[model samples]
Target: MTVLVPGIEGRSACTEERLLIVGLGLIGGSLAAALRSSGFNGQIVACDPNADEVALGKEMGLIDSGGTELAELLENVSMAVLAVPVLAMESVMKTLAGSLSAAAPNVVITDVGSTKATVRECAEAVFGCVPSNMVLGHPIAGSEKSGVSAANPSLYLNHKVILTPEPDVLLDALVRVKTLWQACGAEVLQMSVERHDQVLARTSHLPHLLAFSLVDTLARQDERLDIFRYAAGGFRDFTRIAGSDPVMWRDIFIANRDAVLSSLDDFEAGLARLRQAIECGDSDALIATFDRASHARHYFDTLLNKTSYQAEYHMQPHGKVTYRVRPGGQAQGRLRVPGDKSMSHRSIMLGALAEGVTEVKGFLEGEDSLATLQAFREMGVAIEGPHQGRVTIHGVGMHGLKPPAGPLYVGNSGTAMRLFAGLLAGQAFDSELTGDESLTKRPMGRVADPLRLMGVAIDTAEGGRPPLKIHGGAALKGIDYDMPMASAQVKSCLLLAGMYAEGETRVREPAPTRDHTERMLNGFGYPVSREGDTCWLQGGGKLTAGTIDVPSDISSATFFLVAAAITPGADITLEHVGINPTRIGVINILTLMGADLTLENEREVGGEPVADIRIRYAPLNGIDIPVEQVPLAIDEFPALFIAAANARGTTRLRGAEELRVKESDRIQAMADGLATLGVEHTVVEDGIDIIGNGNDQVPSYGGGRIDSLGDHRIAMAFAIAALRAGDDIIIEDCANVATSFPDFVALVQRIGMSINVGGDNV
Candidate 1:
């Protein structure tokens, strides 16, 4: 016991500890080389049946010492890494089970096997049960090359290493194993053995099998020589893994057999369907598959990069998007923001519940809107063509929706979540609605309490926050309820559930909210009536499909409107924006503040008012904003606050308690951001009073770093605020901007804003 292995004479090895890597091959040798490069002070050694490979590892200076006998190499080892092939793990675990007793008392054993279940089973069989020191692991990095000579130190750099440790595993052992991989420059993560096997079998094992199969299938043809000679980059790239050591791949496939077979079955079914499409000449089918995959690939890229719609849904930590706007840029061009987000969400929901195909134009392809679309697709609806702001939905009729496989993720849309809660309440299957962190914190009690009164069973977090679990098959009866506040989401929730209720449902708002749901419901042949403050719709009514043309969002255009309003001679025109009376609070407030704003080309499209707003810069004199206008322009206050900062006198706002519950507390978020930019503003309980430093000749405010509180409106508001700032304005936590205006920065830059948008995902 306590054997001392010899190393190269000149190298000083640490006697206090040792790290032994079994099977001196590419993976094991790379681990040693990376440790050596990372300046690991412990003695590095290895064990392999191949004597030549052991000698070569020492000669390459990858290991201080190595030997052919694992038993001889075990003494003084603080940790043992088994990098052997999958099928060979049983015998290796047997050797370890017998020999590990001679090593350090707290010695931990981990493996770099491709499949975890088999390895774990092998350990249990050998050690009578899995030892507390065992931390099952797999490094999601490797090469086609084999043996010790192909060792590359940078192989695992930035790659992921997953450790599948059981709950009964020792904490110290798990931490040490995680530390080892981290030291080798791998991003270490933890998961269960079952999940590891399932994921790896599909992502890694299945791909390799296909690569080998594809290459072999093509190589067997008579034109194989010509095929090989004419191969393109894609062919070579796809088949590169076929060049990997055959025996190793054989074991991986055998070890991860069940999950791989399941994945292969799914792949085969899809491939057969595609083959049938080719034979039948179905262009629509072809386009659907190709288009879905094309967008999905881009969507997945955005998910990884943390840039677009899926990013908010994923909420990854590596990237935080930020915006830096240089002072004083012209706001001089004609622009149109994306389609109204409220309408976009309603289109998808009603379309899915309608009886026939519904065609939609000008769909907002932002994260929040897409979350609505994807949720319908999850519930077994056939949807197509969100390409170029067009969507065709093959509706599944009311009461026809299949239950979603799991909870629906609504990115950052409180609108979608609330609306879904009402719609799902009458379904025959239970469902849940979930959202991102920002959406989760906002009040769902406003929607849940009303839906519950309609005889639906639902549950929310401690403060009535998401994720909302709605138990289906409830006998809903409509109720006449007056809302505490004017909220479009709450009203829409009750109205939607009313579709399945037994009698008439009436909702009275304290003030008006966006009426897209009501307008679109009637447009779809579902009768809804409004009398005074109450809107009523009877239950047991049907929704028939209709074409919808969504107008541009005024909420998004407010930022540009405010930019032009604050800067002298900065005349800008926003084209075809929705001027829905209920949503024009920003326009009303700005006009009352004395900005020379006019509407041109006013017309009605699909029952919603649309107009081109041309605002010419004129000196703004701030006034007391009326209480009646607060609900109409609730979303635009952040941008209006910037305009207030540049007005001639003080602007006082009141009766805006609703602003306290937006994605961020609009009152406080704008106030804090304004304070950073050296603007004078006083925060009251429900509203704010901003003192203006209006000047056509000089900057109205001095810029500084401002946190957007991860609110999209706050981010875009400050981005435009830079138009009147004396210095550069840097806005942080701006990624959620994708949820509303995915192209805000690009559109602004096109209209002459000097802004640099950069961050982890941007």
Candidate 2:
């Protein structure tokens, strides 16, 4: 028996074609809401098994009518949309098929599932219909959250809707689905179900699976309890997807088992090769692999909207004091580094240069990075962050950044400021750049002076402070700039400005900096030449649209490396980490300190080197840190400090004055904090010397209090130090850890480290 739920009686006559949507979760409710908002005058009835969800959808007017029973609702609908779990789709389709057979004018069916082939097959078997009328559709839209409560009407606006229709499917039915999707402000694309699954397995499914598996494994480990104490921005991002709906992912994994399995196998193979290379200490193999990966990331950056994507952070506290290094412990399972941060930043920036709206998945949306996006918005970039760290950048073209009416505020990101300075220096309009307190204190002279030499006028406070005012519209000429410091930011700035210079721009560094800028420029159809330690870029090169696959960041992989190196009997594997020569100094330094590190599965990702590293905790001996490695391991020193403190001999670090200008006075902060823990360490103007004896003999400070100084790195560093302390360590003003790693505490706790909030113990 069929029952009809009448439309609003007097408001408007109900169109005979009604669409019934099941599951009033974010995607389901959003579909209904978008349909109505997009001028669909047709009736939209929605149903959810949960009574409260249906009630809320109805109350919120997101649906014309809502209910808990699918059979009752299916009776009157002309078409049905299944927006539930992939595993649940078969049963729901079966119910719809039965109801459609009971009525006349058989209902057209469609589904919004992430994986297509399985869903299409399931639909065919369950509905007993030629697959044409049952369209397997994925809106490629969502957030990290779930439930109807999180639904919003604008979810699909200008997003992609991929349709996988079988050969026997009705063309008319496909057109209707496409039209409906278009009405909801989405562009439609057609692909074979198999291809869709394969591509997404690498681009989407694998990343999520890695994040979940990593967190799950950590949570089940005895060592996980201590992760919260030392986790930083990288771990938070790599494991963020762990917080997603477990049932949903479990279903996705089951449905796309074969493809997911294949992808994992490929990843495993790649990781294994890297492990072999590291074990043999093959520098050539290591450098080649890293170079390839670095190049690929740079190429991928040009296709992304750099301004829209932001970095994220997490912080946690642990009760345990004193870090222990034990040999042969169970290894942390292999982890693919988090989605590339450098690529994430460049994706949003370059995506903004695209002709149409560029949709991006795997974009990081952490707080400190979001500040960069906001700054871009202030500069006239049209960018939006809709649930799940995803972003859409409406590009304005390569030379389209409009001069900001006021100062552009970049918060706590040295990467953003330095790169943007180069881009802005070549622009035609004047702009002022500012930042949060931490950012303001960072050194800008390295980048500023070079741009000034290129005819760009930049005015800063004493010592090239923040609130920098750039006077643009000047005719610039390239210069043969010799880099005094091995700083990537400075080098990148000059190269970025060179893009608009009058002649070839040459930059020579005594030691190499990260070559992301050079590799990316080449990928963008620019002629960028690298000879020894010098890189040259010419002014006139056209950048075209291309697909990019970003490799994992090694900087982000350092935490796991440290974790495995310092935790006794622990072995950990990190997969697909970018081992660019400029960034591999950390690995080199740690290796010199007697850490047992192995690289495996060496391969190229978009021209950069990538591999999996397997590390085992071993008896470590400290050594003198070379001046050349300082710039290479600048961002990694705090962790290095922790490692040094736990090693067997004196560790001397010199030629690292750059630390004084970071988020906090990193060197000073680390020195003071170490002193508080009763560790003997000397702080020089340019470096620090730590004396270690491979024993946890240091007594705790009576107060058990440590200050973060509002620096994320400092906070995370001290927390790791707490592992080796005699008593509970209380880190005060530790909130800034959210700038990079927000899930630090939870991930660590899951592994077995006892961490608590607002207390002296744990």
> Which candidate leads the pack in lDDT?
1
RMSD of 2: 20.5
Where model 2 places Cα greater than 4 Å from the true spot, the runs are 1-337, 354-362, 384-394, 696-703, 757-762
RMSD for each model, in Å, please? 4.2, 20.5
For candidate 2, which ten residues in a row score worst on lDDT? 305-314
Count backbone overlaps in model 2. Answer: 78
Which lDDT tens digits does candidate 1 get at residues 1-762?
Answer: 122232222113222347989999999999998888877888888999999999999899998888988888888788889999989999988787777765555567889998899998898789877887788999999999999999999999999999999788776677677777777889989898899888888788888999999999999999999999999999999889889999998898888889999989988987998899899996545655665565556554654555655453334323587788899888898988899999999998999899988999999988888878777776777788687899998777898898876888787898899899999988989999988778889888988898889999999998999999999988999999999988888899999999999999999998888898899998999999999999999999999998999999999999989988988878899999999999999999999988899999999998899999999898999899999999999889989988999999999999998889889898998999899989898999999999999988898889889989999999999999888889988999987888898778789998888887777323
Residue ranges of candidate 1 with Cα displaced over 4 Å: 1-17, 221-236, 265-292, 300-307, 310-318, 759-762
TM-score of each: 0.91, 0.55
On residues 1-762, what C-alpha lDDT tens digit does candidate 2 reach at each position? 122322222212223458888888989988877777766788888888899888888888878787888888876566778899998888887776676766524566788998887787776687555355677889888777888778777888878899988877766567667777777778789999999999888878899998887887888888887975688999997777777788888888889999999999999987887899899985534544554354325322322422111211122332222222111223356555454566666666656554556566545555445556665665556665534556666656667778765787666678878888888887789988887667787778888898989999998878888878889898889999999878887888888888789989999998767887677656555678989989998885555544445566566567667766777767778777778777888899999999999989998765667788889888678899977777788888988887887888889999888788888888899888777766778889999999874753342222256677877777666665554556766676655555565555544454345556543333
